[model samples]
Structures are given as C-alpha cells and as structure tokens.
Target: MNITAIKDKYERPILSLRITVTNRCNENCLYCHHDGMITSEDEMNADEIYRICKIAKNIGVQKIRLSGGEPLLRKDIVEIVNKIASLNFKDISITSNGTLLEKYAKDLKDAGLNRVNISLDTLNPETYKKITTKNLANSAKRGVLKAIEVGLYPVKINMVLMKGINENEVKDMFEFCKKNRIILQLIELMNSENCDDEKFSKEYHYNLDSISEKLLNICDDVKTRDFMQNRKKYFIDGGEIEIVKPIDNSDFCANCTRLRITPDGKIKPCLLRNDNLVELISYIRKNESDEKLKEIFIKGINKREPYTI
Candidate 1:
C-alpha cells in the first residue's frame, strides 16, 4: 500500500478523498457557498474525474467521496461511478442534494457506489422551500426511499441547522430519519464561501449549546465522539447527529484528513481555507506519467495545515 506524509506533524495517515465531479446543481440551498449553482464556465469532464480517482487509488487512498454542486445532475455520472469502482477502492460514495438522486439510486448502488450522503436541511415543505428556494422535497424524499431500497447502507442525512431558518424542524427531521433507519447529521452553518459570506451574521449563526440541550430532551442519552480533532458526532434518540462548527474557525479543525476536489478538478486540501489546490488531470494529460500523477496526489495530501507550524 502506498502512503504519503502530509505537511502536518506526525499523526494519522491520510486515507479519504472527496472529489467534486460537477459544479452544476439543481437547487439553491441558502447556506452553500455557490447558492448550489455552477459559477464557473469550465467543469471537469467524466474522464478527468476518473483520472484523479485512479491516481488516488494507487496511492493507498481507501475511501473516495463523490461530491459536487450536485453530482447526480451529470448525464454521465453513472459511468464516472463505474470507472471509480473499477479501481477496486475500499469505499465509493456520493454526496448529493437528493433531487436528482431518486432516478439513479439503484443504478449507482449496482454500479459500485457504496453509500450516499443526502443533504436534507429540513423536513417541513415550507421550510424546505425557504431553504432551497425551490419545490423539490418530493424528489428528495423519493431519493431517500430509493437509496435505501437499493441498499445504500448508512444512508446518511446531512441536515444543516440555520437560525431563524429551520431550527424548529430539527426534531421532525430526526423522526423522519429514525423512522427510515437512516443516519441523521445536523451541521452548523459555516459561512465559508462568497455566498455564505453574504449571509454571514449573528442571526444566521445558530449556536451549538442550544442545539445540544434540545437534542438531550428527545434522545435517551446525548453522546458525542471526537472522531477527528474538531468533529463531534451526537447520537440522539438512537439517531446520529453531527455538529460541525464553521470550518473557518481554526481550532475546530485538527484531524484534516480528507481532501476536497472541486467540480472542475481543482484539489482543495481544506474546505475553509480555499488555497493550495493542485490541478491533477490537466497536467497529467500534458505530461502524462504514473509517477507524475502520484506526485500530485502526494502533494495534495502533504499540504495539510490543520495546526500550521
């Protein structure tokens, strides 16, 4: 197995990588950096994404995550997934908004997709509309059902808690996830990108303490796990909820293991600090060598600066 030493001090080995296949999306979630839409004219082609995935696999990256503004929007998404699975990766999963996922859930699972992370911020129809600025809850619900039926184990539900937005829907969302036997994660809104900055304020900021207290009311026992440095997972009423502080806060992120790949093949080492990205495929095609490709993957991992020295 190949391994690379990241820039951080001696710690755990880097093993997971998140690849964003497309900048395009079908919905406009109020909390995302790009309004859940494509801002760039250029996006990564299917082959280009696979190229990166292949290189990562050779270098002992056991887990691969497919993300995007919404990955399911790509017409050739299934092919991309098949190609990644062909690499024999230990895990292959996708993070989608669940609107377009309904149509492909079964196909994806059959094509080697191990699981899915569906971003459902609210369960209330009106709240859903307010958050996504669209009428698409039905599509999301259907996607969840289809994903489970297709055997997307640990079918995780990513719920973002927004103040004055949909905080009231937390319990209902938990019930929906629990009834469906899915993992429900509650995320604190992080004003990371430009669009998020535009809406950044105390009002938009929902504190974790208040959220934690309320979770205890319903959960038989409130428990948290410091999986990584700043990450803490809350288990309420036998439902899994994760609390993520804004990524921008330096102290909150220490176990910076997974790398983020934008839709256009830009490699982001850290989600909060939008810097130090290496273009792997375009450069690979120009020079084209396994050694060169592997080098890029190592460089991306080594650039970790969780606790910069």
Candidate 2:
C-alpha cells in the first residue's frame, strides 16, 4: 500500500491519531476535560480498535496515542497495544494518570509501547488529593518510577499549572523529573466549556508567560517541534521541560496534526469542539469495506479546523 498523507483544507497534514479507549477513569481531577468526549460505555474492543488503526496506518498516520479518562483502566489494554503494535507505527504511546503503571508498564513495554505520558500535578500528597479527590499520590509516583525502570524511554510527566494551588511546585516537580531523567511538560490549565468545571478554569488558570520568561533566561538550548503545535522545548542544566500553552494560542491550533477518535468511536476533528464529530463505528460494525472506512476518514479530515482560529 502506497502511503499518501492526508491533509485538511488548512493544509495541516494528519500525522498523528489519538484514540480514547475508554471514558471510565479512577481519578476525578479538578481540570479533567475528559478529552472533550461524552461519557460512553460503548467502547470499541481490541479487534475494532485494531481495524481503526490499520486504516489509519494505511493513510500514512505514523503515530498512535492511546488516551482515556484513564487508558490503563481497560482490562484488554495489553491486547490493544499488541494489536496496534503489529501495524508497525513509528510511535505507540499512552496518556495515563499513572496509578496503574507499576502493574502494567512492563507488559505494555513488552507489547511494543514506545513511551508514556503520566499526569502528576503536584508532588505534595495533600495537594494531589485535593486536586484529584483521591489519595493515590504514592501510587502515581511509584507508577512513574516503574515506567522508567521498565525502559519506557523519555517518560513524560504532565503537570497542569494551577494558580493558588500547585503553581509554586514547578521547581520541585522539575527536580523530580530531572532526578528521574524524565521530560516534564508544564501545561496551562485549559479554559474550555467541556471541562469538569467552568469556574475551576476561571479560578485556577495560571498564566505561563512569567514561567516561560524565566525558563528562557536559564535554558541551555531551545528547540521548536513544528508538528506538535510549534511548542518550545527548553533544556536547562541537564534537565528538559516543555511548555504546553494551548489556551487561546493561534500557533498551537495552526500547527496541529492530530486526528482524534472518541471512546464511542467517532472521528473528532477538533479537541475543543463537540459539534463536528463524524460517526465511524456504525459502519465498522456493519462490516463495511476498508474503502468505505477510508471515505469516512476522509470526510472527518475534511471537517478539520483550528478551534482557536
């Protein structure tokens, strides 16, 4: 099969596919956006997910990211990873809250997972419980270590900066990531209607400008990733940090190359909007041809647009 890269009308080539394996999560964080997906129990099985990924690979999407309310919650996660890995994607990763990494990281790695991104907002147990409404900080921390030990290279930690909360813990979190040789991603609290709470964003959205300026002065080097919303990665004293400022950023939207699949199996064109989803699983359930699935994929790609712009 000749891989032909698909592009939207905005000329952004689709290079990455993000699939939400399930909406069920163990933690209820204050800033959980649920990946802009409605709660659904009808998640696609491993075989169905494999079919979607196979079609995606045929269309030249080199990267596949498994996400969830918590992707590790799925019992068949290892099987899912094994199936996707067989497609031979350039990258296969997952975004998890990290409480289950200690138990599953080794199996996932052995199944061909390239890396992982774990969410750890604060190292302080009290604050972690306050934010996530769960006292599993120790479990999450251990998961991080286990992932590193299992040889998941470049294990990234996602810390969403929140004002009057964990914002002051930046230096502490960076130190931990540095000690673990992990990449730290400082994410700005997203201001979206799809979030768990609208007032939560208004109350906690910490401006990253001040933080970015500080890192700019001390950084040893800087590199821009064009495919990933042109976000800047900073290297400081043998430690690495990446700033993810997705709120109200035109450049972030302009350079996005990701196509999302909701837990219930719809192609989501934009992360911040729920109106333009193209139904996909219905045809797949109907046992449609691969060419028919390809047409549905193209239809969803045509609907792609920058939410911020």
Candidate 3:
C-alpha cells in the first residue's frame, strides 16, 4: 500500500476521518448537530462502512472517529468497530450519547475502540431531560464509569455550553470530572442546519471567549493542540479541561485536519456547508474498484475549503 497524506487546497493535511454511522439517535438534544449529516434512512451497512474505512486507511487517514445522532443506535455497532479495528488506524474513537454504553462498553473496548467521548451537558437529571427530552443522566454516568472500568482510557465528557442553560455547571462539572478521573470538554454550541433552528441557536449559543479568564484562573498550564482542531487543554489539580471553540471561527477551519462522511456515504468536505460533498454510495453499489474509490476520496479532499472564509 503506497499510502500518502491527502492535503487540501489550503495545504492542510487530512489525517482524521469523522464518520456518522447513522442518524438514528435515542435522544433528541435540542442542540444536536447530527455531525452535519442529513438525517435519512439511507445509512451505509456495516460492510459498506468497513470498505470506506479500509480505503481511508490506505490513503493516510490516521484517526477515525465514529459519530452519529447516536452511533449506538445501530445494533451492529460492535461489528462495525471490529471491522475498523482490523485497519489498525492510529486512533479509533466514538462520540456517543452514552445511554446504551453501559451494556456495550466492554464489547467496544474488545473490538479495538481506543477512547470515547460521551455527551453529558448537565449533570442534573432534570435539566438533562429538559435539554434532551430524555431522563437518562444516571445511565450516562454509569456508562462513563463502565467505559473506564473496561480500560477505555481517557474517557472524555463533552458538555455543550448554552446560555441560560447548563453554563453555570462549569465549576461543578470540573469538580465532578476531577473526582471521576475523566476529561471534561466544554464545547461551544455551533449553528448548523441539524440544530433545532436559527432562533434556538442564536438564543442558546454561548461564547467561550467570555469565560476564558475564568478557565485560565482555574488552570495555569494551558496546552493548545493547534494543528489538531485548535483544541485547548488545561490541567488543574489532576483534572484536565479541553475547550472546543465554535467551528464558525476561521481558526478552527484553518487548522482542521479532518473530513466528514455522512451516514449515507457522502463525502462532506466541510461541515459548515453542504454544497461540496462528493457522492460515494452509488459508486460503491456499482462495485467500484478500490482505486476508483481512492480517486473519489482524492476528489473530496480537493474540494475542501475553509468554510469560515
């Protein structure tokens, strides 16, 4: 396999592949972005998904993160993970709502999942229900604990900061993560078509810029993963905090090394815009050669542009 890194027009290396396995989710979070995927019943089967990942690995994509409205909604999730694991990518992770994780954490770990990022916006069960219309906060917590017990190292909790909502839980969440020995990621809400509406995003989107001072005060040693999504990490009293800025920021696009694949097997070059996706499902259905698929991947990489610009 003569693998070479695929660089976009802006010269950014494509090293990460974020695949939305399915749009079917168990919880309906008001702020869910659906990973910029168009929700439909046209999801790729496990074999189709594995083939894509195999082709991806052949072309220098190092990290693969399985995401969805909720990836666990797919019953064959473990088989999907095992197939991807066979590729031996540098890192293979999943972003899940964690409701069903308690039952599948061990299976996922055994299937070669490196880490997990579970969405836990508010620790309060009532508030969680209000935000997601699901009262599974206790289940999510147990899933996190189970993931840790099963050796899913560095279990990360993703909390979306929303104004007049869960914003006040920063300190409490930090404390909770510190006690639990897990990583806490504070994500700034993004305005995507998958969101409830423009009104809801505008009303709830809280800028992390306002709380930078408070974050710095809590942690002195700040580390920035500049080339890898511009994520900032801070460590305080053995607890780690990562701040994920909004994608609308040009800096986020400028440093992005990732590309996305929607559940239906379309190549989404940019998350903020839906105009440039290269279709792959039809070609795969036609039993296209791996080389032909590789060309499509290259074409998709070429189509990538900074959406914020």
Candidate 4:
C-alpha cells in the first residue's frame, strides 16, 4: 500500500510519533517536564496504543518512540514494545530514566526495541540525588552498561544541562559516553506550559550556545539532522554529542517532524502547547472506524504549527 504522507499547513511532514506510555515516574527530577502532559491518569492500554500506531503507520509515519515521566514505570512496557514492533516501524526506541533499564533492557531488545535514550544528568551520586531526589545514580549507571551489553546500539544518554546544577559536568558526561561508546545528547533546560515556574526556569535554564561553540571548534566531524529541528551532532575522539537547544530556536520549530501522543491518548500537536490537543482515546474506546480515526489524526496534524515561531 503506497500511503501518501500527511503534512501540516507549514509543509512539515509528520514522520515520527512520540507516545508517552505512562506518566508515573520513579524519579523526582527538579527539571522534569512530564512529557508535556497536563494530566497523567487513565493511560491507554497496549491494544489501544497498537490501534493508534496502526493508524499512524497507515498515514506514513515511520518511526515510533515511547517516552514518559519514566517509561519503565509501566509494568507492561515490554508488551507495549512488542505491539509497536509488530507494526514494523522504521525505528522503535524509548526515552527512559534508565533506573530500570538493567532489568528490562534485554527484554525490551528481545521485544524488537531498536535503541534507547536514557537520562543520566550527572555522574556524581550526590549531585544526582540533589537533582532527582533519588539515590539511584549507581543503579542508572548500571542500566546504561546493561543496555549497551544487550546490543541496544547507539544507546543515547539524555543529559538535561541546568545552569547551577549539572552544567559543569558536561565534559565528564561526554568522557563517560566515550568510554562506553554511547551517544550523549546535551539538552538545554526548557520551560513547558505546565512547568512554567518562573523562578525555577530563570535559575536553571542554561544557555547551550557556549557549549555548542566549544563542540563546533573541537569536533572531528559534524552532522546536522534536518528532520530533528536541524540539531547538530558533534563527533569527538570516540564519543558523539548532540546539542539540543530548543528554547527560542525558530529553526528547531521549523524543521520538527514529530507528533506527540499524550499518555491519556490525545494527539499533542506541539510539545510546548497543550491547548490544541485532539482527543483519541474516547473515539478509540467507542470502537470508531479507521476512517474516523484517520480524520482525527488529520485534525491533529492540521493543528500543528511551529511553537517557537
């Protein structure tokens, strides 16, 4: 079936879907955005998720990523992975806190998960506890190693750089990724609609411009991912670092090709705004026809616009 890909009014094609499987998390990170979800209750089941993905697949979406407050919090995560894998997405990955990766990494890989992105903001146990209010830094480190051992290739570490918090640990984090042959993604702290704590954002939002400039000078090679908001990937000696500075970045919003699904099963058009969500679970629960669901998908896509622009 030659399905034509759908594009928003801005002419950006919807190529990837980021589904928040569960809003429940084990860590209380000081900078957590809760996956841009306003509410966390009443998460969709594996079957509903599969139906949503199927509709997405039929609409020419090729990639799928499972995310959450911490995706591993869900007990049926492996089952969810299996169902999504059955749709034959070009890629099946998850963004997790990594505390439970050691226990679920192999099972996830076996269930057709292609890769993983684990959040490890700091290597210092004390600092980790300070940021996350959890004493699981060592456990997360073990999970990182286990993910690599399980052949989850290109296991990426998502390090959200905060001004007075873990910003100074970027070099150390890069070294750690180099030692393990993993990719490091340095994400600038962002303020979302629900997490718009003015004082918190002002205190912790670190500008990534200087770090990006430093990487540009020392990087052996550089690559730009056009589909991913034109983010740059810097290749160092044996390590890889990707700089994600979405705050006030027009190009980032212009080139985005992602559609987010909230944990409660609403089609979230933009990560920064929640007002334009198109409900899906209610229709799915009503056993709506595929045509009806596709209309809902198109309605959501039509709502998509560059949040920064």
Best by lDDT: 2
- Candidate closest to the true structure, highest TM-score: 2
The deviation in Å at residue 153 for candidate 2 is: 1.3
Could you give candidate 2's per-residue lDDT for residues 1-309 as a string of tens digits? 548679999999999999999999999998888887878999999999999999999888999999999999999999999999999999999999999999999999999999999999999999999999999999999999999999998899999999999999999999999999999999998866667455875688898989999999999999998888888999998999999997478888888899999999999988988999999999999999999999999999999887752
* Candidate 3: stretches off by over 4 Å: none
What's the TM-score of each model vs. the native? 0.89, 0.98, 0.96, 0.97
lDDT of 3 by residue, 2-104 (tens): 4677898899988989999989888988887778777878999999999999889988999899999889989999999999999889899999988999999
> Which regions of candidate 4 fall more than 4 Å away from where they truly are?
none
Residue pairs in clash, model 4: none
- Candidate 1 lDDT over 98-170, as tens digits, reads 9877799988988999999999987778889988999999889999989998899989998888788887787
Question: Which parts of model 2 are misplaced by more than 4 Å?
Answer: 196-198
**What's the distance in Å from true for residue 31, model 4?**
1.0
Instruction: Please report how far candidate 4 places residue 206 from its true position, in Å.
Output: 1.2
What is the TM-score of candidate 2?
0.98
- When sorted by TM-score, best at the front, the candidate numbers are 2, 4, 3, 1
Candidate 1 local lDDT, residue 19 = 77
Regarding TM-score, does 2 or 4 come out ahead?
2
Q: Write the per-residue lDDT of candidate 4 for residues 138-240, one digit (tens) a residue.
A: 9999999999999998899999998888888998999999999999999988777666569667788888999999999999999998888789999999789
